[model samples]
Target chain A: MQERVNPDKANLIAGATGDWEVVIGIEIHAQVTSKAKLFSGASTEFGGEPNSHVSLVDAAMPGMLPVINEECVAQAVRTGLGLKAKINLHSVFDRKNYFYPDLPQGYQISQYKHPIVGEGDVILDFKDGSTVTVGIERLHLEQDAGKSLHDQHPEHSFVDLNRSGVALMEIVSKPDLRSSEQAKAFISKLRTILRYLGTCDGNMEQGSMRADINVSVRKPRDDLGTRCEIKNMNSIRFIGQAIDYEARRQIDVIEDGGTIRQETRLFDTRTGETRAMRTKEEAHDYRYFPDPDLLPLEFTQDYVDALDADLPELPDAKKKRFVEDYELSAYDAGVLIASRAASDYFETVATGRDPKLASNWVTGDLFGALNKLGKEIGESPVSAESLGELVDLISDKTISGRIAKDVFDIMLETGEAPAKIVEKRGLKQVTDTGAIEKIVDEIIAANPDQVEQVKTKPKTLGWFVGQVMKATQGKANPQAVNDILREKLEVGEE
Target chain B: MKVDEATVRHIARLARIKVTDEEAKNLETELSAILTWVEQLGEVDTRNVAPLTSVVQMSMKKREDQVSDGDCADDIIANAPEVADHFFVVPKVVE
Candidate 1:
């Protein structure tokens, strides 16, 4: 292990006296991808009618007990394995007592001391070709509370129990982030891993995943400062803004000789500020105890091994393979493997073809065009096989590299195959020596002064080659045009 | 094991119970004696015994991931004090 500087001054804020470093930690609540709730047989579908998905067990009806959902347990274990975390074979559930209109039951079933997953780490890849490992403290399973609609009625709030008792995997990270950029990258990578595992959909818009950010600022090499948690951020943009605002806020308070009070805050999206929602003056004593209704969750080593064997190729492993097998740069591999859809698309195009050329086209032309159109790679108009065929046209010299771009544009506009586009548009390269030599002969005859200069200067042969290519409508093979021009202009001896 | 007046009041507040002064005075003494009797269990020396998780000796029962129940919103809100659009309506809570 390398010894890293904890308070990196690179991410320091300019305080009144000096610079201060920001330390951040994130707790992500990812809804598990299961059909039923965590401890009931109710449907876990989103956007259902109010209270229509609630079961007796979810509503805390008399004589109704919760029966754990088997798929939810498997999903949590899969997420733990995806994070490279340790899976505790023996874990227990406890009751977290709280008061809220949304919580039909007074206590929420969560894991307190013993979580399902232990220590793990996620590798965050930055755009500068740098990587850092963020330590995951633990991941525990809990039930999601119901939704409360405050705007539906004037004096009353409507409670919808559709989301109640849904399973959530609270993946907590250590204070290993220094800047908001790192925090955003950490969440993005973790969400990608979850999506790949099919454990969570990772949709922040529909509220499948949410984050609670902890921000603190301390002097270099000093002890950690008091941190405040900004709760329930769904968008990555908001998370970045919230961290910057909170870090500056804390630095101002300390420079003004005010002690930072530990509190929970909310990020106002409209004003881009963090406001205190509650303070820690009245501490909560949840009095968590092992739930008497449920037994300890115990599994064998063989069960864990089965799930481990069933895991698909994760992003890290896929990236390593792309680098070693495909001979791609780390940056290109990172971009391709960031999402499963794009990575799978690249694999189809690069198989048994020129990989570097395929990568350039996919990451350069396809990505740029998609960005212009505001379309995801999955919704791209050009198919991977069509793009691969375009690569083949360039490699086989049927079309010059410049003409291939024209064919690609036509392919984008018409959604036709590259070969079909080249044939229908008559864009084939003029590679025959007879045809190119004729054009080369005409160019030399037309530019006598340039031809005289080319024999002595020899570098001016490029001018003759450009004229030949222009005369042929950019369909002339560049290599053939250069060869014929050198031979016809008598500049070969030079 | 001794329950004081303030502790009694705090517990009542947490439970959201209304207690009169006379009831608190009597309940403090009653709770202390009950706790003292229960504390006698600490005298037993069974250090090697495991903590009990359940009264019944059985593993956790889990169900398959199938939507086998629900869709009776009327029955669910039948006991609520107020209902609107199949939702249980309560006093407005901003937080």
Candidate 2:
């Protein structure tokens, strides 16, 4: 990825004395791609009726044997391989004891001491050209708790078990993020990697993925200070804002002779501030123990190797290939490889076409239009072949670059092929020099009084050129008209 | 690691359960005795021993990624204490 254009004052938290460096680490809870719940044969689809997707096992019924879902484990391994992390052949699940109204079982089944995936690293490319590698401490499989809908009734709360027992992959990262921007970039890059690997959809809106940001500010070469965790931040924009708010809040507290307390806080999106949640001052003892209902999760080297063989091209590698093979700037490559579908769409459009032209249209006009319409590239009205053909028309001088924009708008509205639209509308450029010069001669003849002024007011010559283009219905070659007019008007000027 | 009356009372409050002072005092003695008895395992010098997380050794079992098991709300919520409109409702929580 190309470096950010304005990356000068990056990731720095300015304080009273000097710029204080903020240490950031994020824990992401990504829902595993599976058809059923982790322990029960229940649906994991979103927007289901409140209790429609629940099963007896999910409701903590007595004598319900918790059967593990195999696809969930495989998806975690695939994610681990995509991160280039170690896939532990042997892992364990333990019960995380807790109490909440939504938790029907009074405990969550999670991997405590022994996780499935270990020690992976992700290289995040900034918009300005710099890159940093954040370390993945581990990826553990856990079961999600049910939802408590407090808004359902005015006087009572309702419990929804649809999400309960769904599989979750909690990927923890090391404290390698230096600033809020870095934290956001790390998440975006990680989301791209996850989408490419087909493990988790990484949809933060539906709560398929959420982040817990641990932020602490310290002076240069100082020890780590008291850190606070902002929990369940879903939006990428909100993550950056929350980190900035928390970091500054900490610095202010310390400068005002108040000691920072380590606690869990929530980011209030409405007020754009961080508020501490009411909880015990001391951390709760999770009291994790091995779940006796299930056995140790073990796999073979062949299983890990097979999953590795099927791994897709991750974002970093794909971005590097786009830069090396297509000769595109890192910025363009980064934008193109933001999503798997976008990357595939770009490859098809860039093939056998002028790559730089293809890159500009795809990243600039195409993306801009989609952003306006609030649509994804996959849902675009203009297909890749149509856009590619439009680029080809400009490259081959069939239509000038300006005419291509008109044709593109028509294509978006009418879904017509670029060549067909150009043909029907007579938008093709007039490449014949003889035809262009004839119109140019006619313009100079009619405007004799203004022709003498062309020497002193060279800028007004554009009016004569525009008149010629208007006469030809905007099909005349712009360069041919300019050259013929410049040559003809130069006769008496010298 | 020693359990005392004050610690027992605090734990009960954290767990959101009601425990009387006499019960807490009696429970502390029993809990401390159990903890003291279990502390004998710590005396062993098993520095090289690997930590055991699971007693039964097996691989993870998986199912195909297909949404096949829903639409049984009546059966799933059969044991709820109170239900309204296919939902389990509790006394209103202010927080």
Candidate 3:
């Protein structure tokens, strides 16, 4: 989580080592969460039977015309809005002419110079309480290519068209990120926001999202240096590592009086380095032209307004509310609002309850349990109401904090209410003075010498209190146990 | 917009196409003509006309945040050149 040096440090590094500063930008390809593909009626499902979801158009059958999916369009707009970008009322799809076995159409249907959304910004907050705002160049909609399964055979490769023609929102960021850490934080925060906005699922592991990292190094205040594009980085950790290694590699080359070459590179995860893939191609190389078959897309202001009305409270707004309304710290607010489900659960638990305590348990105990079970907050067996009730029991002194943890465990296993779990297991706290006094009497009589020692030492009163708590099986109210032990041991005046 | 011989060859390689020098020369001319036509858009004064990114301007449609079985194995694998059970089959990839 080390951030790359600021411009000042970068200048110093350049001056001392005669090296260069690294400039970075990322183009994130996020799969729109829709059931159908962008230009075909094919299913946009992952890991399907290899080619089952392919439509005639997706398969590039002759005479098949592409039809735009409205849901895909809506998702693109929603994503643009989530990023605070300008939604173009009109957008055109151009055919990027290229040839590969994976692309049966011989060209990819994509947006060119004219993208659907333009000029936005994303503010990323690091775990260290620092923040940076990354500029977004554009967010455009495009169709995905089919997958090539090279590992399927030694002599032959297989193509899976199930993913072909799926809607992709290519979000392009400006070269505002100086280090790979900032780039990764930007991606993570962007994913969180997209997930909250319900625009994209942001599942990088499942290939629903991926990033293309463009890295370059230059002497401080010098002109922008030659950049190499890193392709298809799916994990945030790998993205950071790739950037660090690539930047260092560039710096080393320049320091050795070698010129950096502009090319495309692939990061080798095993070796923790990057290798040349190919020379980077400019736009002219693709022979881009507007597709004559499809008409330009146009929409009315009313349609866009309708979409705006349906937008959920985005992550930034919700984060601000968590801080302002709930009085949570910035770090706590950021953690709680990382995901929509977690934030919604927190809201339910915090309603009319102590926000700080609720935030602690939700972010702490609940998250720990979820991590142990390899489950998400949405999949937890503990309901919000049940967790809230347990917190209430602790607040009301009905159960000791330690006993509540045990009750919470049972609630998770049995899917029972906290109240029912406590009652069934006889786990209620011994808050009654009479009940606590009985346990204190037993402990004091058994350890009379130690009780006298505690009276003299004063601080050893904690040991007597521990004895009383053990006698009551940890269900004893801690304060009640301490009071009874002090009274029984004559450490406090009656 | 002129596509030189080197430009044609570079593009062909990027697209994974094997083109003869003679074919590359012919493509250069054809591609140049095409680019000339596309270059006419520069004269249309699109300064205020918003660039179109998609055919529709609707915002994203959201479904309930639930995961369901994708469930289309037979249909997906139907177009595979070869198949074994529900999986696509090919020559052994590893020794």
Candidate 4:
């Protein structure tokens, strides 16, 4: 006679103080990593000369029939293998009929009933170190619509066909995510995986990878309620924000005796709110039918297996190896492996040197400098070999930790090796005991009163140490100064 | 599957279409028929069959690790509905 509680409901309530369960699913449109468009030979380059990349098929010129780009098909199969999804042997492209100024052909060639890839899952690692597997409903290919430039004129809008006909993989997720944090983590992990797979660049700003978030709030133990989709969220931060706002908005509306409307909403970054753009369209509204112009795409198992064999180490596997082999902390491992460039940089530095130290520099000092310089890890001014040499200098006692910072700054500015910068600037640590003792003795002699106080108050000697360090221009070995100072001050106590 | 007149009117408004009452009524019948045909898809044992999201199987295409694009003012402004020299033209909304 125990109460039958909904597991999904229970998990939802534990996260938020409400009877509501937030069902989240993401449809990620990743621009395919191909040189040409799916149906045309147009260049799939981003930020091109508006319509210069457009082909006759892309322009929707009369009598133009789309010739399938074999490379695009290969890329799709590779992506399917990367997702661990079942790549269908036979899939047909259907016409997603719609009317929009940006859609030159009046129909988008997309998969309707039979998609290339089937159900899969992505494992997401949160900041708290807990892992969750978000189910992948499907991944399909479609042509991108041309961009509509609305701000160009008050009376007329302009169209840029550069993006049109570009192949995109629409990765749909199951309603497994319950919170915005989980959603963000899922997306970040997915991006890393895609980048590692060499499938998608996962660039949000450049419009390579974007998400359409579907959010619905239902009472605990109740059937699924109406869902609203927030479309074209270009940033992961905005995705999280939109989900949080939309979920709260839905819950508040329902609690206030209002019904949740199922519609397509637009997230306005300027206002930080979602507005209803249009009512949700049903499948029939688009009048989807098999695209008569194109043939059914079929691939052999050998082709899919070949792609699977060549997939670079995925994020999850790489992260595990980073933790196990490199002995990196979960946080440090996650940050380092989040981007392929960052991880590659870490490997170059940690090739033979200490993994922990290499991780600290890459995630902390190196990352900090890169952020300040507005440069990505790939564009870092300091070479990995040079950074490794810098850390090696500290380990070898050639340069003290304090002196290394000055050398690092010079290296960043001049793009010189740390050792070269140290040599040029004469930044080597004065580890010679005889030289450090003389400066410590001079400071102790000049500040006799302070030195006397140091006997009674042992902590007072730290001030003398600081003076000695400054007088040596931070070149004196700090450990040497501390050792000599403590030995000199604690003469009576010893 | 049976779309009522009110539903059709609501759908049209949602779609941003300025349809008359007669058109709404006609669309209701037409939409209902379409939905009924689509409903036949639901009857299929698609529980095991995956929902196909894309036509082709592919990953994203990557370009060389180089900045190949540069600002081409003339090319960008060529298709502008209104243009002034190298820049796009917009109506002055504010004084």
Best by DockQ: 1
Task: Give fnat for candidate 2.
Answer: 0.70
Candidate 1 residues A188-292, lDDT tens each? 999999999999999999899999999988887677899999999999999999999999999999999999988889999999999998543324767788987
**Candidate 1 — which pairs collide?**
none
Native contacts retained by candidate 4:
0.00
Model 1 spans > 4 angstroms off? A1-5, A279-283, A440-470, A482-494
Give the Cα error of residue A92 in candidate 2, in Å.
1.1
Model 2 spans > 4 angstroms off: A1-10, A281-283, A491-494, B10-17, B42-68, B93-95
- Tens digit of per-residue lDDT, candidate 3, span B13-75: 867789997898899999999999999988898889865634766543332322222346565
Tens-place lDDT per residue, model 3, A293-365, is 6777667778888998999998889999999999999999999988999999999999989999899989999
lDDT of 1 by residue, B1-95 (tens): 99999989887876668999999999999999999999999999879998888888888988999999989898899999999899999999884
For residue A157, give model 1's deviation from the true position in Å: 2.2
Worst 10 residues of 2 chain A by lDDT: A1-10
Interface Cα root-mean-square deviation for all models: 1.2, 2.5, 7.2, 8.9
Choose 2 or 4, whichever is better by lDDT: 2
Best by lDDT: 1
The total number of steric clashes, by the backbone 3 Å criterion, in model 2 comes to 12
Candidate 2, position B1, lDDT: 54
- In order, the Cα lDDT scores of the candidates are 0.90, 0.87, 0.82, 0.80
Best by TM-score: 2
DockQ, candidate 2, comes to 0.60
- Residue-level lDDT tens digits of model 4 in A81-143: 777777897888899987666677889999988898898878887667877888888888899
